[model samples]
Target chain A: MRFTILFSISLLLTGSRGFAQQRFVLEQSSISFHSDGVIEDIAATNTNVSSIFDASKGEIAYLLNMKDFQFPKKLMQVHFNEKYVESEKYPRASFEGKIVGFDPAVEGLQQVNAVGRMTIHGVTKDVQFPGTVERKGGMLAMKANFILKLQDYAIKVPQIVWQNIAQQVEVTVDFNYRAQ
Target chain B: MMRRILPFVFLLPLLAHAQGDLLDELNKTKPGTDYTIATFKGTRLVNGHTIETKQAGTLEFIFAHRFGPLDGGVYEMFGLDEAFVRLGLDYGITDNLSVSIGRNSADKIMDSYVKYKALSQRSGQKSFPFTLTALGGVAYSISPRRDDEPEGFETVDRLAYTGQLLLARKFSPRLSLQLMPTFIHKNAVSKTVERNDHVALGVGGRLKLTRSVALTTEYYYRLDPPDNDVLEAQTLSPRYNSLGFGIDIETGGHVFQLVLTNTTSLTERTFITQTQGDFFDGKIHLGFNVTRTFQLKKQERR
Candidate 1:
């Protein structure tokens, strides 16, 4: 009976330690999107995205204000918020998901995939994308590049400006996270 | 059984808080207040200025035209034969400050002005209700000579100065209103018959019809009308209040404004004090303004 109790205690301790969630916060990050239209090429970047990372459970969450996106041309920024995003009605875009194939003990650099629901313009969809995650010393950095189809999220572009904006946009996300 | 139950107890807390903790971290920081943007389609509502100003390091090129009164009859081709043009360049030094220089063909006049945005309207945590801008402008007549000059128009006497306060409110995405309290000073005027100073109140409104189109209107009423003797001696058509109607069309980086107004002159110096037409009468003029904006500096998101 003593041996059974010892085994139970040891299993419970190991399970608790493995399942414990370790919180990490975004230190510095950049999220950018590029649209290669037939007539014009447009791009915007955002640095004010709020995010939290869980290294043990390999989970991630991101929340960003649509108006936070910055463009080289101020008019484009206004059009993005007013006509495209309708930011007044839906001011936020968010993503919450899990990162697979990330092993903290293995450290170094590893290839991983993030599976999550990305919400934009008040529309949400399931997305799975590949990324590179590197753990160096005390910080973990993630870099990802993916192509997003606007129609998939119901972000429609009027026919008049069809040549001004592309139907598919390439989005790049880079983030450095540190333990909280 | 004890080992299986013990492991579940430890794992339950981790699974339950997975979504909750991340959500809490995000809710901790809400976005700052949202400032109102694109209150009016263009910088000019109709004949007068609007609360709109160019963003920092942006340059705008304006080409405008005003034709003679529609009542000029067929010989004038319904006024299209007589077209006065104005070319202007406006530059934004900052998001809230801008300066412009322009020359109008009507009186061979040169105009230079500065505008400052004092307050912005915002909604959210600490909100503001209205937008305000202060504008000061000076115009000079470069004409060699005119039969009816304000004292033969000497170098200094050709100058006129104007000051205005633009107050505007966007009641909704579709409706916006503005009120302008204007003051003008002329370097010289007919002795006692015409005062050197004039005061007027202008009211304007814009109704957005679509994402790319809007309707705008403005009227300026003079508080002190010059005496009849000043008008008759100057050989001028009786001075009347300025009234205008405009349609704004926006595409890509260009803004086109179609105007119908009783005020023929484009410069505030003459339009505010020496308007010749009456909207009630058939003295309306057709005009148009087209502006294109270019970004001079890169504003990258950091």
Candidate 2:
């Protein structure tokens, strides 16, 4: 009888561990801008996501080939190589942040903060964003929302499009990381 | 008399022969030698040019897909939507030269022309990093016309030509713009009045509104008096040539265009026609074009 009880407990522990391991990736991740009078939006998306951990201290990151963050159609794709992001010169945009007050034991759901440095268009800024850390089954899901201002990142929104584009752009980041 | 006359006649024949040979050589060479074939993909469409692309030797399936269906509805009555589909193939005979043949969707008009990259914005990759410029071939429309027209009317049914120049620059990741200067020539004006060919300046651009959607607009201005210059004789007041405005929403292989154009003619030539009641009264056209790219058979490479 004792052997049966111990075996059951061990099985539960293994099941929880599997749920805790999570990995989420966005095939097309982008932040867009829209405003009055003019209808113009810009989206920058490339493979940009990183692994997350609980209990143990680990870093999470998001990367984007700033050069690859294409504009509208082929126009952006062609001139993109030479003009804007200067992909040939400055290859990538990245962010490195670690989860704070993160604990896997508490279970359920809890609000946490991720402190990190985000580099965009070659400029980096320190940011502290609030996110919900979810522990479900054996998976970990992190969802956060933050505002990113173009001027802050030194991304000069052109005057021609000044009226169309907003000075401050809103960004949302959601990641689900599973155990490898 | 015999010797002198013989010598004169022989010389005349020789001169004619020489002239004929020169003419023949000129005919063999494509027109617009000095101009570059300034054809990039039309900014109106997402893919760029309307010309069908060919790879290897066979027709590339992707190229075939570049051209959408041949749609002719009642809109053709007012010449509102009279377009066939044209896929042009350009060949580079030399590094600095290329020639192209394009078929129009309306009337199946075929255009053959040559372009020269006289100068490129990207010279050796470093000269002008921000701006690109090119001067090239003028496009000519060559479609067979009916020999006879109904009685009592003038026929403006002849091949027309246009010289186009393309210039583009990117200000940043979110903004980019292009300018095209086009000169259009027509043999005869509408039956209403007499006028010369039309010269127009076009400005177009693509702004990334979102990752998948873009705000696209183009404006055409006749450097000379608009077609309305002829209209004044009949209407007391002349009306300006049609102005075009459109937006392109692209997702995957599909492109949907919401346009507010005074004229519905898609081709550059047809739109140049001076017609009334074609102007937009807020009644816009919603056009959607979807292109599917596929790999062609190994033997189909062109």
Candidate 3:
């Protein structure tokens, strides 16, 4: 009877340990967006990103500072943060989602789906996109490409420069995470 | 023994699920700092200065024009027939420091100034209620000295200096206000004036009417009015405080301003102490200014 209790306690401890060890922290990440306007092309990239992945529960989260995005033109950068994003009022954009088929024990690259809520410019909306998760050398790398509608987030573009901005924007995220 | 082990096994996955609240953990690590932006679109608020400054490594080109008094009627084509132009360039040496140079056609005066931001309004760890900036400038008249001036006038007599302390606050996303305490000193005055030093207080505000448009107004009150006796004896016209009202429109890389003002001079030294036109008498000139910015620094690839 004593041996049975000891064996169960050991199993419980190992189970909790395995779950805790599955948490991963992002080592490097990049987020970029592109929009094709009638009069011009708008593009920006933000490399300062923070994110976490939990393979044990198929959970992931990402946070990006809006002011950190770099544009080819300084004035455009100012307009993006001031007029479009209103970064002062809404400083950060974030996402919280679950990987459809994430497994810590799985090896190699696996295509998966992510479904969650994305918050930007003080507005939140449901989003779903296809992604890939690669597990190699005891680390996980995630890459995703998606499209977002500016109107959905309540980002208003005035009629004066209507042709200078696009209705839809393409966003791509790449993150490589290591065990916490 | 089986009962105890069964309960522990059931709680294991629940505990693992709770551990997946990674977002909460990330939130805790994020620095709590928020800095306000776009307090005002440009550095100038009509005829007065604001606390706004250019970002590091940026260059701005400005073209300003003011026409004759609108009261001139159709003969003057509603003030469009005669134009006084000021062309300027400003460069940001650092995020908080900038330098500008301009030449005004009204007096054929060359102007240069250096501006430094002393404090910025923000919340969280570093919180301040208002922004503060220091501005100092000099204007040198390129026009020949008047023959009516007293003898022994040197070249330095054509120089004037200006200093101002600007305080501003972004009260809301749509409203911003500023106060300017200004001082101007002229090396030589027209013999009638008793003193060359002039002090003034200026107030300015901006109200956003739309996402890309704002209504701006400013007024400067002279504290030390020129000697009335000297003014009436030697001057044909009387001087009044400067007043301006305008609208600002912003595009991607450009800002355009349309204004009406009683002052034809573009620099602080001339406008603060030498405004002879009065708005109440319909002596206001129609004006507009265009500003374009360029990024001079190359961004590093990460």
- Candidate 2 vs candidate 3: which has greater lDDT? 3
lDDT of 2: 0.47
Per-residue accuracy of model 2 over B119-204 as CA lDDT, tens digit each? 43332224443333333333333444444444543434455665666556544444556666666666644545545466666676
B-chain TM-score, candidate 1: 0.88
For each candidate, report its DockQ versus the true two-chain complex.
0.36, 0.01, 0.39
Q: Name the lDDT value of residue A81 in candidate 2.
A: 39
Cα displacement (angstroms), candidate 1, residue A157, comes to 2.6
Clash pairs, model 1 backbone:
none
Output the worst ten-in-a-row residue range by lDDT, candidate 3 chain B.
B10-19
TM-score of chain A of 3: 0.88
lDDT digits (tens) for residues B28-81 of candidate 3: 777755677788888778866678888888898988888999899999997889
Predictions in order: lDDT: 0.85, 0.47, 0.85
> Which scores higher on TM-score, 1 or 2?
1
* Model 3 misplacement above 4 A: A1-21, A159-162, B1-19, B145-150, B191-194
Candidate 1 residue-wise lDDT, A117-172, digit = tens: 89988999999999988987668899999999888877777757446898889999
Segments of candidate 2 deviating more than 4 angstroms: A1-180, B1-100, B105-108, B112-145, B149-157, B190-194, B226-229, B232-239, B251-258, B273-283, B289-302
Give the per-residue Cα lDDT of candidate 1 at A122.
93
Candidate 1 residues B1-302, lDDT tens each?
87657656655644566445574568677658889888897888777789888899999998888899899899998898988888998888999999999999988999998999999989988799999999999998887576655544568988999999999998988899999999999987766567899999999999989877899999998997886666777775588899999999988789999999998788788888888888889899999999999999978556
lDDT of 2 at A54: 31
